[model samples]
Target: MSSIDIQHPHTLAPAKARKAVEEVAKKLAERFDVEYGWVGDTLNFSRSGVDGKIALQPNQLHVSAQLGFLLGALKGPIESEIRRVLEERFK
Candidate 1:
């Protein structure tokens, strides 16, 4: 298994950040068939070959995920896409 951990800083208010995260999650669910939900300020998500959580902090978002064997091989591209998404949405 491969793991990904990223801390992204943002300036949006908590409520707005949460909404942005929800939008991201919805898109992930639609595109990747993932299932996700919120637990306080954290959003937990999973699918057949992955599991992860995004924890929202006052000034940062912590994203962590574990990829299964097949997906692990594609980690670099996946991580890059995630970073791109964060930059696009949180900026």
Candidate 2:
């Protein structure tokens, strides 16, 4: 499986960071059927052929996803979108 791991450092409060991650999760779920929730401070998400987590820290938001064979082919666009969304929301 190909992996998409992105770490974005931020100075936002934990609550705000969580909210941002939640918004991304919601949008992802709409199109990808992603299932997600908080496991302690980490937002874990998964679906067939994909799995990842958004680890919320005081000054950093780490996002990671693993794509299976079929989906791996689209890794570039997928990663790009994730980057775009993170930049948009976490700004």
Candidate 3:
């Protein structure tokens, strides 16, 4: 299994960050076949082909993802979609 970590720093407050995280998680869950949960300050998820953590901070957001499928199979598209959604929601 390979992994990719994508981080985005936001200028929002903690409350906004939390909301953005939840929104992103819900969208990702609905769009992809993944299981996600909030544990403390981090949101974790795993599907048959992918696993990752979405860590939220007051001024920063970190997304650490692991793709278990082939190198170029599912990683690029999923990562792109995740990035787009995060940017759209958090900005």
Q: Please tell me which predicted candidate would have the highest lDDT against the true structure.
A: 1
After the best TM-score superposition of candidate 3, give how far the Cα of residue 16 lies from its true spot, in angstroms.
1.5
Task: Report clash pairs, candidate 2.
Answer: none
lDDT of 1 by residue, 1-91 (tens): 9999999999999999999999999999999999999999999999999999999999899999999999999999999999999999997
What tens digits encode model 2's per-residue C-alpha lDDT throughout 22-43?
8878988998798998899999
> TM-score: which is higher, 1 or 2?
1
In model 3, pairs of residues that clash are: none
**Each candidate's clash count:** 0, 0, 0
User: What are the lDDT figures for the candidates, one per model?
Assistant: 0.98, 0.88, 0.79
Q: What is the C-alpha RMSD of each candidate to the true structure, in Å?
A: 0.4, 1.0, 1.8
Ranking by lDDT: 1, 2, 3
Q: Which wins on TM-score, candidate 1 or candidate 3?
A: 1
Candidate 1 vs 2: which has more lDDT: 1
- The Cα error of candidate 2 at residue 75, in Å, is 0.7
Q: How accurate locally is residue 27 in candidate 3, as Cα lDDT from 0 to 100? A: 72
Error of 3 at 70 (Å): 4.3
Which consecutive 10 residues in model 1 have the weakest lDDT in total?
82-91
TM-score of every candidate: 0.98, 0.93, 0.83
